[model samples]
Target: MSQNLAEPVAHDGCLLSDLAAALGVASDTADVRVTSVTSATDMAVPGSLFVALPGARTHGAAHAAAAAERGAVAALTDEAGAERTRAAGLPTVVHPAPREVLGRAAAFVYGTEPGDPRLIAVTGTNGKTTTTYLLHALFEALGVRDGLSGTVERRVGEHAVETRLSGRLTTPEADYLHGLVARMREERVEAASLEVSAQAITHHRVDGLLFDVAVFTNLTQDHLDDYGTLDNYFAAKLPLFTPERSRRGVTLIDDEWGRRLAAEAAVPMTTVSTDPGADADWHLATREVGLDRTEFDLTARDGRSLSSAVNQPGWFVALDTALSIVALTEIGYDLDRIDAALAGRGGLEARLPGRLDPVNPGGEGPRIYVDYGHTPASFRTVLTTLRGFTKGRLFMVFGADGDRDATKRPDMARSAALADVVVVTDYNPRFEDPAAIRATLVRTLEDEFPGLEHYEIPDSAEGIDKAVSLAEEGDIIFVGGHGHRQDVEVRGRLIPYSVKDAARAALAKHGWSTR
Candidate 1:
């Protein structure tokens, strides 16, 4: 994938010495000009400042020569990398920790100042991508040009940047993030919504940028492979609500984590919840959950109420909508204008691609949906929502990602048990045994729900075909785990794949017409 979606059209290159001074580092180079900044050596261009940091497998300093060959003018690194970079005939700036300072350096290089494009950040275990999309759509509805950065795609106004490889990270690296903001500024984008992952904060990807408002959705058990515990995962996300990261905060108090975050957050926070009994600034009451839409009412503690609907079916969708609306209000957008925009457009106009995205909307034998849900909580929520919309049998086709949090595999099986039929298939089995991953899921399902109808298919495409063949009219098929992804990883190779296309082909093969 490309390191960044866009860059500023124009930038007066900064002196290398000035960059070092901004990073609070010492540099010997006096007049060297640095135009851009990047951590990846392959992204280096002429007059670029290459940040070389320590890595797990190898040191980035080892690639200083390659970066220099790619037209990099100077290098920023610690004492260990300084010698290697200097030996490669490039002037180097020495820092105690280059990764920690990368965002600041990139911000300085890209000329990104405070409140540039009016940043709004969303972070949590689930709903981050959808909330960001809703925020961006809300911006458009209010007649404001906006930029978006999230898991599915990045957008600058009407221009959408496709994910380069199998998938893009939920959040880009620090340098690329700053460059995206700079590009937004160039395009005169009035605001930008960023989906900040826990890993992004832990890795220092969002260090330099200060958000006008930071939003926290409900958190659940996820990313245990990185954090090792749920508490650690929550801790990783808490920093985004600090004064240095955001000026105001909006959080969902539906879960304990959200309530805790609201209490612990350093910035001024607005609390929101769907529960009527919960103490929050805003309360979201679900008025209706139709097949195509979910109507909700947001009432403030001060007795103000705004009614709206999301063109998606789910109570969770209502929560996400309420969070987005409350976030807008916290950022000083008029509540009446926000309500009018929603009512005028018949609800949120943003199509959350791969997020409960219907594959065969009109012409179809079975209603099929491709979703990006991977966590246990996400699976439970999506499956429960799909159950309400399904008239006939519900077929759940999904698999766990190999080399990820394997502890959640059994829990995932329990969630999928909600479906009438479960088809276990291979997902991205990167560097791990695909068969073993499938076996774990199969064993769990068989042991826990022996009477449940299930099938084990290693190939995801074949699994979809099996599900389609079994599904009758009015039935629903949900393909999960690889939503919006175009490829599957196995043994470190990204094989071309798409669940939506595969499901369509399967439907066609079963003598069903597809659009």
Candidate 2:
């Protein structure tokens, strides 16, 4: 894609007539003066151009009256919403697809020209957050101040803003995503690292933005409910590597999917792999992983060799770090500088939650960890990671989220089978039956790891308490699922709940002192 981002100020405070011609919105009377734009009706300001688009369960047109009642200057929407806006006596800007034009239209109204810093986009089924964090760390090591945006949160240098949204949907709405980027540009960040989701591309959320370098970590089982199949899921991630979407591409070739993506990507590309026989431009070797750190040797295809280290200890993260280095160097950061910025980069807090976290610094009790590992792949990895750290039994407390890909329930059970003791609990049930979800997983695990201690605690909070009460010194109690989430979905409302907080509370009640 073109490196030039559409100028935001090109049509700033432009009149309705001006906006119509520029955006190709046809109407008899284009007298509405558009001052701003927003997708959230609750946040709709007076004189703001509120976009009412189609939603999954209902039409956003249903909210047009509410948006107009909130003092929206006009509503830009499809035919149905236009009728509602006009009926409400609010001006209407009709479009075939309002969500598609949101970012460009918002940029037209509020954005400035693109800044100088290189923009790196990281995408894949998993590890996007960790990779982006690693890149930000790499950039910082290279003496570059950068901005971060991903599933975890958004940060510019040392300042971080908590993210309030769904994790399955990684791509924020177009208006918010671009606004964040514009703010980052204004902050003079030398580089911007973002996690691009397949959903983002499919929904046209990041449609107008340009990516300088795109990195693919690896794609595996995920979002199958939305995409419907593995092939469809893979197709969703392919857009970021196309020449029209990125200037350069980096692929982590450890997975067969990554190798295929590297072969098909239209842009100039570099491949990273930990597999010795894989055809990658950069390779990682001589790895070491500890509770607190990991080190590895990197051998570039160009004949340069380097040793690297990270504060994070996941063994699977080795290629992710290497991919970050390749993307940063290709985008122009020097090697030495890259290494330095990453020095201060620590593991994402509570990402794997409670798994590696110490229970209490001084208390004589087993270590406890809380993580959000709902997928089979994640379940297996977390269990394996904890198994390595165990001197005694590895106790796993986890559950399946309701109303999700039902087929994966068996896999999750298989992963939990690896643990010494498995206690099933409720995750976000949303609209689905929580008890049924728990039974499915519990059945799968029992079938494989029969007679292994298993408990079906439908309540997350109570279930966590059970696991902690069962903990003994030198044991590891892992409460998995709901990482970084502070709420639980029951019926339709999200009740306040936190996995990490509960784990800590349970540990404390079980005679463990705070760190």
Candidate 3:
């Protein structure tokens, strides 16, 4: 919670003339010094500027007293919030849209301008973590030390800073985002990569920053609860690729959506794919997929083919590898640099968790994988992929998150029906009734495949234990939903539990050898 030394507070504020120009505030009489910047009233430090924004339930101006008491020197607000902020003897920065300008205001205070660094943004429903890490690896190979922000971790060069960030809600608010980037600048990071969430674009979390290159992995049917429609969700994400200033784009044409996106992109565009007939700028032909390593032939637009090996397990990793190649090439790196870096590039730890991973010792009956596949598309994709490798029955243990897009619950059930045995369970019920969610999923699965063996075990831990008991030799048990999440939000509080850890515990209890 301490103020960063690299971004010391400007108690006297930045030069009033400079601030006005940067903020596009044309008024000459508005001269003020800002000590700090904050969005939450409770965290408002003395001499800090409080950003009062309209929230889902209440306006931030309603907490003006708390902010003022905590040392807020001034407040930025719209007309409705101006009177409240002004009454507290706090200087007011009145504007029609204060929330939209907070990131720029914070960047102005922090002395970091747009496009000052090589900012690369990767957006998609999946593969963001792998793509971000892949870009980080490419940067390392080229001696380009960089900062990275994603679901798994945030790092500035080799130093992994613990981030209070998680899940598909990838991008943080602009204030924290710019501040993090400013810290990366202070850390002497030449480049930085971050996952731009669809919500981030909708909420303007990345408004002030311009990406040097934007990557689109693909889009699918997810986050319908927020956007109301898949088209609206995709539209929210399209702007990142079509930035007015920064237009260099690298898209993975593995999916139909990626193919469609490439056609509409205005920036210097490069297409990458693992599929044949890509006609893409970068193509990867999968040569082999062993348990421990995957080899591929990467051919660039210039007709140079680079034979590479990625030390990762998924059959679908080719899609990720192709995107990584395109990302590196767009950043002005050559094939030799890409090959040398990836030669030593290790697997992204903890991303695939127990399922795709074979870290367990031999004679463990069947391998169980714990993943975060909830949507029908992701569920089907994971199940179908696992089905390809399973010589025996495939037992699936999964359930939809509560109060989310309930529309996908039936589709998830249908996908699970494809498995030899389906064990449905809970995953972060939030406030919605867990039993209701389970019943809905179970009923749908039963209706779709009446003859399919299915069980309803609401407690996820119990379901894991049961799955391990039912696994036979060559059977692959997939414990999907809640991958890398340390806790499940039940009601309003977080219960410490992880699907991967729980799966491991189940294996140990069932007399399986875990190295």
Quick one: best lDDT, which candidate? 1
- Name the top TM-score candidate: 1
lDDT of 1: 0.88
Clashes of each: 0, 14, 4
The CA lDDT at 281 in model 3 is 85
By summed lDDT, the worst window of 10 consecutive residues in model 2 runs over: 1-10
Q: Which digits, one per residue and each the tens of the lDDT, describe model 3 over residues 334-392?
A: 77766765665543222333335442536567877666556676677677877877889
**Candidate 1 wrongly placed segments (more than 4 Å):** 1-8, 161-167
Whole-model lDDT per candidate:
0.88, 0.73, 0.74
- C-alpha TM-score for every candidate: 0.96, 0.89, 0.90
lDDT of 3: 0.74
Sort every candidate by lDDT, greatest first: 1, 3, 2
Q: Write the number of the candidate with greater TM-score, choosing between 2 and 3.
A: 3
Lowest lDDT 10-residue stretch of candidate 3: 1-10
Task: For model 2, state the Cα shift of residue 138 in Å.
Answer: 3.0
lDDT of 2 by residue, 8-66 (tens): 22234557666666678775484777666668776565677778888888777677788
